[model samples]
Target: MAITSANQLELLQTAEAVAREKMIDPGLVIEAMEESLARAAKSRYGAEMDIRVSIDRKTGRATFSRVRTVVEDEELENYQSELTVAQAKQYLDNPSIGDTIVDEVPPVELGRIAAQSAKQVILQKVREAERERQYEEFKDRAGTIINGQVKREEYGNIIVDIGRGEAVLRRNEKIGRESYRPNDRIRVYIKDVRREPRGPQIFLSRTAPEFMAELFKMEVPEIYDGIIEIKAVARDPGSRAKIAVISYDSSIDPVGACVGMRGSRVQAVVNELQGEKIDIIPWNEDQPTFLVNALQPAEVSKVVLDEEAERIEVVVPDDQLSLAIGRRGQNVRLASQLTGLDIDIMTEAQESERRQKEFAERTTLFMEALDLDEFFAQLLVSEGFSNLEEVAYVELDELLVIDGVDEDTANELQARARDFIEAVNKQALDKARELGVEDSLVEFDGLTPQMILALAEDGVKTLEDFATCADWELAGGWTTVDGQRVKDDGVLEKFDMGLEEAQNLVMTARVQLGWVDPSELEADVEDEAPETSEEEEA
Candidate 1:
């Protein structure tokens, strides 16, 4: 393109103006203009030549040139970019094989079409700069609150004007009862900033629990100052919410501080939420205590914790069941989220009935397995004998705890229980041998002979077969039966192996079979070994 004095003088000014308007580097705009001018020059010069353009960074003067590289005759891959040693002598005397030579080219007139191409190049650069700016501005703003105007609505989703750019509040992320007209002000959580094929998309949410946390941080000085920490938050947007807070200072009460003077602080947040109720709970370190606090306003009669399963069984009075469970189980569900444990709520009556049923089942099991009479089995069950293993392994004094039970009778019952287990083991071994299971598998750490038989029965007859099974599969897992999930015991459980033990044994088998290198196995073992040691210490 021709660089007239008038156009040349205006180019730098145009770049500055566009840079200010697009909030981008002025140098980038100038560079885009250079590229546009170079492409236009390609129409004047042969497109095969290595045509190039450069605009003075300080001055607006633009120059066009062609570049060629001197190469050995055999190395001349491209006629445009490379010149042979003999041919290079035309441009430069005593030319070597690797030197580059730049030659000046006369400028051509900048036609209407060429000008249009330059305009497009400028616009493209501006757009890319704007997208990068938007991404950088919002990326770190995730989990923080943002205020915006309701710009427009498409289907059920709302587009919000966040000052410089528009963000989307998806239909699912909006509170069910909330609606916004265009130009209405709204507060939302910056859930994410994603780069899409079109551009950077900012995703906003009104229902995220972090939004509630940020709101409290705005309203409560203690929370904002980090004097009181919001441990966890659970929300049923447009309905009820629970937040657990704790304070390190003994003088400060975290719950009261969050509630504010006469409930003003919490009420402000509640008003912003359109009257959604908020429960401020004092967080406790103990799981049972935290659970009790989370399941507030409902009296929990009993709490049974299973650390291995990460579950809590909460028994409440029959009258408090509905309150503890909330509408369609929302209360217990939120409590579960707050504590990071699965919660099962039951009424006192239901729990009592379950205990009685369990007692009856245990009595029946003992009666059938040990050939014992109802009275003796019931006595054993009463003495807390829940299974054959427990009965076989318990001290003699534990059996004596049952009324009218003597040492001889206890010994005889344990002997029968052991005999039954031995018979079962012999049957499994015989069947396993018939199924062609190797003896090597039976001797592996954490694998019992019975587990080997179970593995063989399930077609895991080799070390490789056992090694490839997932941890859940090895330690037993649930399968859906008629849409209901049911537990089927795995071989590891048959051998009384914990989940970690099962994983370790299978990993060892993998390393032994050369499926995994010994060094990689050691690395994994080192990473996992510390946690295992801590658990064992605990």
Candidate 2:
């Protein structure tokens, strides 16, 4: 074993310490040294020459050997040459056809170059190993809050030194109202971890939604314990945020607990977020009610849902509209994101006018379809009977009992009621057939072709048969049809009917024509037409 110099010995120990501290395999460092030595050997010698080197870890001693190729002649100058059989036999008992001679080189000749090469290899390998170590150490911590020292500020970005590594806090990630100074200890949520050529890159954020969530976890015990669940959160960090909270236990007031006594709990989070206002609302299962609550500090008079449009129109007092909409519409914007609804805030007067227009349209439709008198039509409207089903399904005697309804008028109303039902039912059947809703029509037996034709004429031509046939829906409400009338004599009847058994004959004809199954009739109950007075008939 050869003794190493004190300076060389210190270098070896320092390399070992770095390897140990970084958890790098000492063997990997030696392997890197061997590879580097091989490269240096090639650089020193021509391509035809081969060199092998080995390092002893205990003594830091290295040995070098040179190998030469055997050739027929000494044609190459300044080169190790081949040996003839006679000359090779002098050195060995037997020499083969293809063989190489090994020569040991003096350590002094290669020592200076080998030491320099080995040092470079060890330094490069240590950097790579340290980078890999740092990447693995921080990759697991992505999306967690880490305490870091503000290292420096560059172009509005704050660079944070997170102990093991440094992270970039982009301008967008900083709370606008908060200022960070060098050496300031702060907690930032890790937004992402990325691997770069230099080392692991950590991206941190203070404005992220999770930043607020983490603050809540630290400040509120209920949140940490999972008793209060944050259903959704929306924010304009450093300004305001809206969070929806729900409690598993009925006894817990989620918002109250989150708010804390004297606003201690939420205020801690607010302070951390640079005094951002948080509106913690109780989550409700009913969407309209929930939306109304989400738009807090503003009273809502009503919430009208337009499901087809995927929007909600909230009616508030004129004075509260701006409050409901918030500054630059932030309140309603966050509310919409939290509730997954498009919110439109409307003043009370605007909503009232819209309601009046809708009511007027419904009233006009009901009167035209039922052929009812203006007085009765208005009466129906006032009673919330805006459509035909409410009018047609109302018991005839019950309607007669209402004010201004006499026996004769009641009888006439009943006849008209039967005609209206038949017409509406026929339209439904036609619509069902047109919509390929034969199976659904089978559910309601006694539907005839004439009835179906009547319905088709009334613009009902699909199995989704009804006044409103939309996406498998059967809108069975009264809608107006032309050429329908109530006779003045109080006998509800259709003109130009020569057939005596027309009433019973209509079903028989439908059955014979195979338009409807006989089984359908059995399943269907027959609707009797009101009897006509002989005096009125004359």
Candidate 3:
């Protein structure tokens, strides 16, 4: 085959036809054709030569050129494609080191082998362009819902024809045991779009929590109009789900809007989800209040929140215990997800027993630590005294308020508590010293004797070692591993150290060691401080 005038327009027609069929840019196909021709020309003109080809967009005229660049004397590596600046003087009046000299060359006559190789190059380039077009089309469409036809089922995964491209709905992303054959109409959430080596991959999901939220948005006018917001969603996929919604408009009830007249809106979403039950709860700023709403139809007697740990304790009546926990602990689990907290559900009796047990433990601590009688310790515990430190440092007037206690008795109680605490501290300090704790660490202002002992026990003896520690290492934190929260016990966590306090202590140590500048810390603090308007300042 030869690039003759008769076949010049045929090349462009073929590019246009392929571009239209693949739904890609015609220019990309034309560029691919030019590259294929150039590769064929290189084979004919000699592989060492730089052969270039271009096709006219309108006339479809094929032009071939031989390009050689003038280079420095020592940098001229290619004899056929590069020329020294002095040697280029023969071709031009004055040639610079980086100038390229182009000379028109006859088009390549493609043999059977050359034509086949050219076809392969064009096909690969067109395939890459098609993949790029698909990736660009769906990249921004992720996190949306799309309607498509099921193309085929491969290894339990449903491949769907989503208009110009195909998407895979993995078996795990399907709702329950939902199955579809070819040509089945399906609605799925566009979970992700990724560009891989093989091609662009579009992952579709029917069980994502966002899929339910999107369905509600489509069904409810308020949600679509932004008057109502979906705060949170937790799904068991086809079995049950919990959605938290809030209304910006006081006149509109978010839950009622989603439910529609006679449960029409929610029912539409439920039907699409393979009859998945959805509990719509009102959103609340208070997490405990919101959690109570999430665990619906179950009466909550009390709600306790540990803000630092992001954990909650829900106490219900003994009869409502099973209801609050639900079948296989589904209710509580959904509530935990909705509130972003770890929830512990217990009966009222269990809560009461736990409280009594805690009270007994505190009474025992006071009895042994202060060397007081059971009656005196119980009285102290009743007065909200939990530790020897509290008993030692409390206002004298507070101790005087206890029944059967006078000023002299209060003085004696404080003396005994202070002595015991000082003795315990001295013992801890001695133990830390035995563990080779340095004076630099012991003298640090933020840490107590027990904190120092704890750090020393963890092999952090020097001030530099303490400074190198992460804040989480001193203030126990939770880590999500394999989608489950795992507790990381910190060295000084038992001393009630918080992340912020640990951070400040470590920064202070760094500043004292000259590892960080005080001025830079001040600048950072200023940068973090919120700007205030003049009216607010006033």
Candidate 4:
């Protein structure tokens, strides 16, 4: 066979260039070409014909070697079929008994086959190499944004031409409110990158939460400079987004800074997101306040957070219910995500009805516990004696003032109220001990030995001890303790110590410890003067 033409040299150089560009080994391309040529040759010639194809990297010239089996009869009939041992010796140094003759096939016959096989091999190799490159390029950018041009649409999915490769933006990934056209430039987050036998698959998204965050970074200077940090973000993409933002500096208003003057900064972000509304909520350590902020534009009357249930019951005016919940529950939904709470929205009317029902249930429990009838309970309720505390504290004259209550009934009611109050106080003291309320005693008119013992274990040895503890400390500590550590002054602060209660406790403790006289302690307590005067008269 003669030397190949210039076209053959160009082909080999092109293959080498492609291999380098795709970061594939040149030897691999040559090997693939050889395999393809072997398959092609076997189909073209007889299977008995031994064939080998080699490519010269420097010149791009291809050569094919043909060897035939040395047979006794040479029954196989083909161009390069069989050869005798003596006939093979002409091309071999020392021909063995079964040695086949080796000869170079003419370039003309093998050129067409080699060229076709090389073309298919190079195309396949280039594709596989490109896939590997794409996988490597996108793996690091899994959670980041990428800008690309819309390439084409197939089966409701948009193919994006990212600089290095193509990415598929599935229908679900598209922001529901917007449309895109071919050649349209858009920014999308690289949701995931996966490898497949066909090629590397790049999944793109426009509705991801990070997309809103990235848009903010692009539009808001404060966010870019780290003056304001977006603590968390939640979005009902194409509709609204709630971003919990906090500012490092006190002077910087995180919500206003994110919103910018006249809504310019957020408007830019909104425009980028195709007019998606954004709620820049000031992130608060207080879950209730944060939730209130998260459900913005709707004034919240109260937010009752149930930490144990991870749920929040939000109370708003009846008129603000729709606004708080937003269209199709977008506001509450975003609030739930931002605050990590299952938010339940309630109107003022609904809340009022609920409170009424709760009050009725509580009243029923109170009456049943005291073995009282509804008439007596209603009479007590009319006197503003809803519970044992009110019943114990209210005067007999106050009870008689209520409708349907005579002086005799008032006296009986007072006695009953006193008894009910003492019993409940004893129960509460026991519960406080079980809850590990330290140095906390609850003193009513009368208490039992069991109640005193429980109070002592709770760290409340006497009325002096009870008066020394803050109300909040008592409430908070009792709520959290599971018969574990006892509450102390240090623990009171952790339980949100109230200043007024703490002051009162200090005064009481000073009097009880004899650091200050009872007269001094009662100096500011108006109600105690009458009690002291009565005790002196007795």
Candidate 5:
């Protein structure tokens, strides 16, 4: 094919048609055509020549040119593409060493092989443009729902034709036992859109928790209008799910709005999810109260929460144990996910047994440590005195409230408790020193002798070592691994050290060692402090 007057406009017509089909910009196709023509021109006009081609966007006229650059005599390497300033005097009044001289050249006629190569180049460029267009179109659409048709099945995965591009619904992303044939309409959540070597990979999902929340937003007018918000969602997918919702307006009920007048809205969502049952609970700011709501259909006797550990214990009647835990522990698992806490469900009988065991253990410790009889130890335990430290430091009035205990008896109890604690502390300090613990760490405030011994045993023997430790390292914390929370033990965790206390103690040690400026610490604290409004301040 030859670039002549006969088909000059045909080039642009072809570009427009291809761009329309690919849903890409027509300018990109025209740019691809120019490069293909230039490549073919170079093959005929000598490969070493600087051949360039430009197509007029309006008239679609192709112009070919050969460019040569003026270089210094010593730097000129290619004679066909380079010219010296002295050699360029004939064509110009003055030419600099970096100036270019362009000469109009006749366009090359495309032979059979050259035309085929040019077509391939245009096709490759068009494909790249199409991929880029797809990526740009769907990048921001992630975390949204889209309706598409099943194109085909690759192994167990579903390839969906999502308007401008194809998306992949992985086998694991589908609801349990979900099967689809070609041309089946499906609604999916746009889980992710990633740019790869082949193209933009749009991954779709039918089992995401966000999918249910979005469905409610689509069905409930209140949710769409921002009167209600979906706080959390946990789904078992194709089985059962739970959603916590909150309403901004006191007159509007979030749960009722989602449920509809007679369960129309929730039923619609249930049909889409293949009959998965859903429990819509009202959201509460208090975690324990929220957890009680999350574990529905079961009566809870009491709730115990450990804020630092992100764990909770729920006591239910023995008959409701199976209901609270659900079949295969699904109810508790979903509740845990919704509340972001690890839940331990026990019957009321079990809780009482555990309490009795703890009481017995505390009573025995007091009896052995303070040289008291069983009855006296039990009485102290019954009075809510759990440990020697509380007994040693408690005021006389507190002990005086106990039956058969006067001021003299209270004084005697404190002396015995203090003496026992001092002996234990001295033993621990001596053990820590035997383990090569430095005096700098031993004299550090806020750490007990037992804490020092624990740190010494863990190879943290110096103040520098303690200062270098992370807050989580001093106070045990939970880590999420493989979608499950795992506990990380801390050396000082046994002393009930919280992360804030650990951070403060570490900062104090750093200040004492001159590793950190106290002024900077104070500035950081001030920066973190919340500002009060003028009205509140007044």
Candidate 6:
């Protein structure tokens, strides 16, 4: 092989060019080449022997050397890593234990098989560098907008050539009516940047709520400048969208700023969206006010919010029911998304009928369960005693507010309520134990007796199972569609818990099980365990 220093110069130049085009450090490419040469050197010399290679960055000279560590006769294992001091003296005048002796070796010629292996190494390293470069470049830019041209399509997915890289816009992430041809320029939201086995896979989306939010940010100076905050966004792509905005500076009207003079600002966004109707509503702290604003163009008569359930019941004028509901429930569904609450719409007539039905049911419950006279039951129903649980749990002072009920009568009702609840809980606990729930898990604090039974029913029979659960896995969280936080269909909702209660319950279990490090905790659960154990024993 007629290899020369001049030939090595060409190798350096090629590596530099590849590194520049791939946007990676040139030193990394050279290191990979060194590794490739070292492997080739090993094939010629003893495959099991220690070999190392280095390339001169300036001169591009590749050199191979065999390495041996000097050790005592008893410590010597093999030539790959160790050599006895007596054997090492042949190469060096004197050798001490732990010292290294490296001898120069002739460079290996890149034969057919060796050349192919080296090429694979270089390509693999380059691909890895490229993926890392792409990940670093786009990870910070996630949730931002980029403009790209459609390069091609495969399996209903579009490949767009963004400025520095190619990205994929998945089929579900495309707007329903939107179509693109090759070279068609389109804006997309940087949905995610993931490092896959093959390379970095960038996901793009035009139908994402953030995509619309980003467009508004670009079109409206107020949003870009931080004078106006786009609080929340919801979209039915290619059809309609709703955005909630709030002003940090009260002088600037968020809606007006977004609207722009003569509708030019919002009109730009709408045009980009291909005539998707845009609703710009002012955000409010009060959830009811926010829901009212979100369900715009529909006149609402009353809003009944069940905060624990994260649900809203909207009663509209009988004439406005169709409008509130919209065509095929579209308006209400959008409102639910925008407000992050489940909404049940009712016309005034329907609401009145529902109220009458509920009243009759509650009156019957009080009469049958509480052993109250019909007059007293109707009175209790009028006072909003929906169930025995509420009557049992409400403060004595609240029960005293009921007409014809004095302090003594309130006390008597509360006593009966407690007796009924204790009886029901005893039955549930007996059933849970029969189902083989672990005593330690059943005795764990922060979980109600009912929650314990539910856990057992779900086959979470051990503290380990309960401790391993994520708060969301136990409680549930807002669902995401293409990286947008949509709504909560949480598993914890099936249990009687509100999300907050579930969070506490899961955290308590984790702390008690010692799954977390002691330094990570603000206080010790160990201190509290004695009290709990005593209570359980009693």
User: Which prediction has the highest TM-score against the true structure?
Assistant: 3
lDDT of 4 by residue, 179-280 (tens): 778999988998888888873389988888887888788777888899989899998778888888899999989888888889898898888787888878
After superposition of all CA atoms, the RMSD between model 6 and the true structure is 7.2
Clashes of each: 0, 7, 0, 1, 0, 0
Worst 10-residue lDDT window for candidate 3 reads: 195-204
- lDDT of all predictions, in order shown? 0.85, 0.70, 0.92, 0.73, 0.93, 0.84
Per-candidate TM equals 0.89, 0.58, 0.96, 0.58, 0.92, 0.77
376-431 per-residue lDDT for model 2 (tens digits): 76766776665565566677776765778787876676567667767876776566
Q: Which pairs clash inside model 4? A: 439-459
Candidate 4: regions farther than 4 A off: 1-8, 17-31, 41-56, 61-118, 365-370, 375-538
RMSD of 1: 4.1
Clashing pairs in model 6?
none
- lDDT of candidate 3 over 1-538, digit per residue (tens): 9999899999989989999999999999999888989999998889999999999999799999999999999998999999998889989999998899999998879999989998999999998988888899999999999999999999899999999988899999999999898999999999999997793389999989999999999999899899999999999998989999999999998899999999999999999999989999999999889989999989998999988867899999999998898888888888888889999889989988998998999999988987889998999999898888888899999999889999999999899989998999999999999999999999999899999999998999999999999999999898999867788998888878888899999999999899999999899999999999999989
Question: Which segments of candidate 2 are over 4 A away from where they belong?
Answer: 1-11, 20-35, 45-57, 61-124, 198-200, 306-310, 358-538
lDDT winner among the candidates? 5
**Cα-lDDT of candidate 3:** 0.92
**Roughly what TM-score does model 1 have, to 2 decimal places?**
0.89
Worst 10 residues of 2 by lDDT: 484-493
Clashing pairs in 2: 427-455, 431-461, 431-462, 431-463, 432-462, 432-463, 435-462
**Candidate 1 lDDT over residue span 490-509, tens digit each:** 66666555677777787788
Q: What is the lDDT of candidate 5?
A: 0.93
After superposition, candidate 5 runs with Cα above 4 Å error: 44-49, 68-98, 111-113, 510-538
lDDT of candidate model 2 versus the reference: 0.70
